[model samples]
Structure formats: structure tokens, C-alpha cells
Target: MPIAHIHVLAGHPRPVLKQLLREASAAFAQALDAPPERLQVWITEVDPELYAIAGEPADEVLARTPRAQAEIPLIRMALMEGRSTETLHRVMAALSATTARVLGGDPQRVRVQIDHVHPDRWAIGGVPASQARAAELARRAAGQGG
Candidate 1:
């Protein structure tokens, strides 16, 4: 399974946020070669007063700069380790483009961090993924042919 957490400043329209979730899930599914039903993408909205940049609150920063220019979104992705570097790069580009297109910001302003966890370190239903998802993992390794 792959999970993505996108952090953005609060106050964006609900429709935009919903679009982000839907599009981001599609991006991850296509780039990571995972089933869309198995992927999770969520948004975390933060208050401007609680977020800071360059020692100033985001609320103050946006007051001086246009919201579109100043808003920066942080995305964190967690997945099982073992994907090729090419796949990782592709997912990053896909996510950046998706964020920029949906949120009306520069793609460069989007930050993505991917954490590849060992299967043994991840759990499903209280069982280590390595043990619980062995057949699924094998199918994935075999070009998703199963």
C-alpha cells in the first residue's frame, strides 16, 4: 500500500482540496504501479498562524506576497521499499504537476518527501506486511500479472 499526506494552508476551497485528493491518488496509482483502491491520499490543512516561514507566521508572509506566490505545499509519501529510481522520479514529477495544476501554484513550490519503508517494518492488520502481503508483493514483483 502507498500513503500520501499533503499539507497545505487552511482556507482553500473544499472543491479544490477534494480534487487534489482524487488527482493525487490517480498520480500515485499510475506512477507507483499500484491499484487505485490500495492507495491513500489525504490533505492536512494548517492554520496560517501555526505555520511559519523565515521566522514569520504564514499569515504575515501571505499579507505581503500574493497567496499564489507564497503558498507552499508539503507532501509526504510512505511506501514499501524496492521501487526503481525511475519510478520514484516519475511519481515526484506527477505529484508536483498535480499539485500545481489543482492548487494554482508553481510546481517548484511543491515539496515532496518519500519514505520507503521495509516491508517488515510496515504492518497490516497487526501483521508485518512482509508476512501479510507476501502473495500481493510477489504478484507486484511479477509485473502485476496476477
Candidate 2:
């Protein structure tokens, strides 16, 4: 499951958060080739002036008419194995683009991080617990097994 925690200072409308949740969930589902029901997302609106911008303080960013700063930390995890680096890169691009478009953030300043996950984090349809990170860990462990 993918959970995007958008920790921005409180002040934004509720619809915005809802929209974010929808977009994030869809993005993750498509990115991992999973069904929409298989994804989960969370939007956390932090207090204003909590997150900083650039090297300066976030209060400065809040001083603007928007009066709110948003820090979108998105994490999409999938049990699928064998995703190429290029594929991951494109996913990042699409995610960032969509987030920027939806949330009205500076695309240049936006950031997105991708990770391979263990499916165990989710027990789909009462399936047994599993680790989405299993294969990745195994690969890394074997690489360093020596």
C-alpha cells in the first residue's frame, strides 16, 4: 500500500486534501500495476510554519498570500519484483508532475522518492501476511551475502 503523508501547515480547504488522497492513491496503483483497492494513502496537514523552504524558514513562505507551506512526502511500495531503474525514474517523473499539478507547488522544488516493498505489509482479501520488501532484501542480502 502507498501512503502519501502531506505534512503541510493547517489552513488549506478539506477538498484539497481529499483530492490529494485520490491522486496519490491512483498514482501508486498505476505505478505498481496494482488495483486501486490495493492502495492506501494518508494526508497530514501540519501546522503552518512547521516546514521550511529552501535554506530560509517556512514562515517566510507562509508570509505570502497562500500563508501555508506544503511538504509532500510520498512513498509508493509494491511487491512486484524486477522493476528496471528506468521504469522507477519515469514513475518518479509522473508522480512529481501530477503532484505539482494537483497541489499547486513549484515543480522544480517538488521531490518524490520511490521504494520496493514487501507485500506482507498488506494482507489482501485475508491473505496471509507477507513482506513486500522480501525479494529486494533478498537481492541486497545476496549481493552482500559474502
Candidate 3:
């Protein structure tokens, strides 16, 4: 499972927020080989006055550079450990690409951070994720999709 926490300056309309969630989930599902059913997304909107860039508040930045608003989406993703470095890099790139496509931001400005946690530290239904991962791998090895 992967959880993406998106932070943005407050005051986007509902539709934009909805699209962010939808598009980000699809990006993770496709890029990380995870099912959408296991993807969790959370959006946190910070007050413009509380967010700053290069020592200026969001409103000040916007006043100085209108395009700064489109560059404000910050995403933090948490995933299970044990994935290869190539997989992580691919997912990060895909996430940035999808975010730019969905939000019309400059791809260079899309910020993404991924944190990998040991599966033994995560659990579902009292079973550690490492155990679940083993089972899932066995299923895959046996020609059953996990």
C-alpha cells in the first residue's frame, strides 16, 4: 500500500482537488504496480499566509509571480520498503509527470518525496505487512495475481 499526502496553498475549488486525488491515485497504481484499492490519498490545504517561498508568503509570491501558484503542489508518499531503486525512481518520475498533466504545473516544479517503511512496522488485520508481502509473492509465483 502507498499513501500520498498532498499539500497545497488553500482555496482551490472542489473540482481541482477532486482531480488531484483521482489523477494521483491512477499514477501511483500504474507506476508502482499497486492496485488502486490499496492506495490512500490525503490532501492538506495550508493557509496562503502560512506558506512561503524564498522568504515571501504565498500571496506575496503570487503577486510577484502569478505562475507560482501552479508550482505549489507538494506530495509526500509513504510506501513499503523492499522495492528496488529503479522502481522508486520510476514511480517518482511518473508521479511528477501525472501531477503536471493534471494540474497544469511546470513539471520541474512538482515536488515529490517518497518514504520507505519496513513492512514489519506496518500491519493489516493484526498481520504484519511483511507476512502479507510473502503471501502475495507466493500468490504471484503460483500464477495468481495479488
Candidate 4:
């Protein structure tokens, strides 16, 4: 399973935010070679007055600079910890590209952080994933030929 949490400065239109959710979900699914239904993505908008850049309030930054140039969305993702480094890199690049495109910001400014968790540490319905989804994990491992 893959879960992505996107944090952006408040001000973007609702439609843009919705597009980000849809596009990002597709990107993650495609890059992970996983079904769309297995992925989860959500966005949290932060008030500009509450966020800062270089010790300056983001509201002040936005007042002087264009929103596209001033805004930098931070994306954090959590996934099971068995993917190869190459696969992780691909996922990061895909997410960065998607965030930049949907948010109208430079791809280089997008921030992506991934946290890999062992199955024993992840849970579903109060049961550790290691035990609750062992068969599914086995099938995925087999499909990946790992």
C-alpha cells in the first residue's frame, strides 16, 4: 500500500487541488506498478500567514512574488519497505513532476520525502500487516520477481 500526504500553501483554487489529487494518485499507481485502488492521496492546505520561508512569512513572500514561483509543496509518502532504490527514485521523480505540473511550480522546488516501514510496523484493522496481509505481500513479491 502507498499513502501520500501533500502539504501546500493555502490560496490555490479548489479545482486545482482536486486535479492534484487525481493526477498524483495516477502517478503513484503508475510508478509503483500497483492498482489505483491500493493508493491513497490527500492534501492539506496551510495558511500562508502560518507558513514561512527563510524566516519570512509566506504571506509576505506571496505579496512580492508570484504564487507559482513562491509556493513549494511538500509531499510525504509512506510505503512498505521492500522496494529497490531504483524503484524509489522513480517514484520520487514521478511525484515531483506531478506536483510541479498540477501546482504550477518549478519541479526543482517540489519536495518529496518517503518513509519506508516494515510490514511488522504497519497495521490494518488492528492487526499487523505482516500477519494480516501475508498472502498479499507474498503475491506482490512474486509478481516483482524479487
Candidate 5:
């Protein structure tokens, strides 16, 4: 299964996130050769205070720049459980291309982060773990989360 974990700031509206998510899932499904249902994607929409862009303060950057109106701090992570690193890169490339247009921003600005996690180490709908670590993908695992 290819799991894609996405963490985005709450600055954008719901629809944009939805678009990116759908595209991301499709990207993973195609790249990893996994079924849509088997491809797991977890999205964490954090408050602006909780997210940062390129190491810049979220609120400050948003407040000072007009890009904030159309641009959001986005972090996309793809996990290739039982897959190859080459496949993960291809997935990220597709995700960035589709997501930038979906979110209405320069495609170059979107950031992609991919990491691996264990099924037992992740949790959702409950305090499975700290938010910091809750956003990783695992291989050879059941569904704890993405």
C-alpha cells in the first residue's frame, strides 16, 4: 500500500484541500500500483499557528504578503509501503503538478515531505500519538493511520 500523509495549514478553504487530496490520492494510486481503497492518505489541517512555510512564521508571512491570499503552507508526504524510492519521487512529482493548480498557487512553492512509519505507531480519531509524529507513513503495517 502507498500511503500519502498531507499536513496543510488552515489558511485555505475546504474545497482547495479537497481537490489536492483527491489528486494526491490518485497520484499515489497510480504510482504505487495500489488500489484507491488500499492507498491510504491522512490529512492534518493545522491552524496557521501550528504550521510554518519555508521556516517563516505562518501568521506573519500571511499577514505581510499578498501571496497568503492565494497561497497556503502545504506539506505533502508520500509513503511507499512495500515499494521503491523511485516510485515515491514519481508520486511527489505528480502531486506537486496537480496540487499547485488545485490550490491556485505557483507550483514551485509547494513543498513535499515523504517519510515512513509503522502501523502500530500511528493513530487517528484519538490521541494515538503527539501531532508531531502522527504524520508519518509506515511499511509492513496494518491501519493505525497514514
Candidate 6:
């Protein structure tokens, strides 16, 4: 499963945010080989006073540069480590494009943080994901798991 945490200054319409979530899920499904249903997306709307850019609050930044109001979304993605650098790079590119399309976000202003966690550091149920993943891989190789 891939978990995405997105933060943006509060203002965009709910429809836009919904579209963004939809697009982001699709992007993850395609780029990470994760099932769409298994993807986890969390959007956090931050007040302009709480979100700062370049040492200035978002509101101040926007007041100083009106044209940049729609450009400051930040996306953070966490996934199990093991994927190749090339794959991660592609995921970031796809996500950035999807975000830009949904919100008309500026490519330069959009920020993405991808965190790859070791399987041993994560868990599902009571078992470490490293063990579960190993078993799953074994089963898949034996044609017993999907």
C-alpha cells in the first residue's frame, strides 16, 4: 500500500480536491503497481496563517504575489522500500503532472516528498510487512498468490 499525505492552503473548492484525489489515486495505481483500492490518500487543508512559504505565511505570500495563490500544494508519499530509483522518479513525475492538471497548480510551486520506508519498519496486522511481503513473493512465485 502507498500512503499519500497532501497539504494545501485552504481555499480550493471541494470538487477540485476530489478530482485531485481521484487523479492521484489513479497515478499511484499505475506507477506503483498498487491496487487502486489499496491506495491511501489523506488531504490536509492548512490555514494560510499556518502554511508558510519563503519565511512568509501563505496569506502574506499570496498578498505579496496574488498570482501565486493557487500554487502551493505539497504532497508527501510514503511507500515500502525496494522499488528502484527509476520507478520512484517516474511516480513523482506522474503525481506532479496529475496535481498540476487538477488544480492548475504551478509546476515550480508544487512540492513532493517521497519517503521509502523499510518493510521491517512497517506492519500489517500483527506481523511485520517484511515477513508478509516475503511470504507473498514466495507464494506468487509458486503461483499461489496474486
Candidate with maximal TM-score: 4
C-alpha lDDT of residue 111 in model 6 = 85
**Tell me, what's the RMSD of every candidate?**
1.3, 6.9, 2.5, 1.5, 7.8, 2.8
What is candidate 4's lDDT per residue for 1-146, written digit by digit as tens? 68999999999999999999999999999898888997999999999999998889999999999988888899999999888788899999999999999888999999999999999999899899999989888987776531
- Supply every candidate's count of residue pairs whose N, Cα or C atoms clash at under 3 angstroms: 0, 13, 0, 0, 2, 0
Question: How many angstroms is residue 115 displaced in model 1 relative to the true structure, after the best TM-score fit?
Answer: 0.8
Estimate the lDDT of model 1. 0.90
> What TM-score does model 5 achieve against the real structure?
0.64
lDDT of 2 by residue, 1-146 (tens): 44444444566678976787788678766765555774666656665456655654666666764541334444343433345576577667766666666777655545665555545545546653355345544764465320
lDDT for 32 (candidate 6): 72
TM-score for each predicted model, relative to the true structure: 0.94, 0.63, 0.86, 0.95, 0.64, 0.86
Q: Tens digit of lDDT per residue, candidate 6, span 1-146?
A: 68988887788799988988888889978887667887898789888888777777777777767534544778899987666687788888888788877877666777889998877888888778879778765654575633
Task: For residues 22-94, write the lDDT of model 5, one tens digit per residue.
Answer: 8878877776666699677767877766556668767667788765353553554635334456767777777
| lDDT agreement with native, every candidate | 0.90, 0.57, 0.79, 0.91, 0.63, 0.78
How many backbone clashes are present in model 4? Answer: 0
Q: How are the candidates ranked when ordered by lDDT, highest leading?
A: 4, 1, 3, 6, 5, 2
> Per the 3 Å backbone cut-off, how many clashing residue pairs does candidate 5 have?
2
lDDT of 3: 0.79
RMSD of 3: 2.5
| Candidate maximizing lDDT | 4
Tens digit per residue, CA lDDT, model 1, 22-125: 99999989988787998999999999999997789999998898877888899999978878789899999999999989999999999999999999999999
Runs in model 5 deviating more than 4 A are: 53-56, 68-82, 117-146
The 10-residue segment of model 4 with minimum total lDDT is 137-146
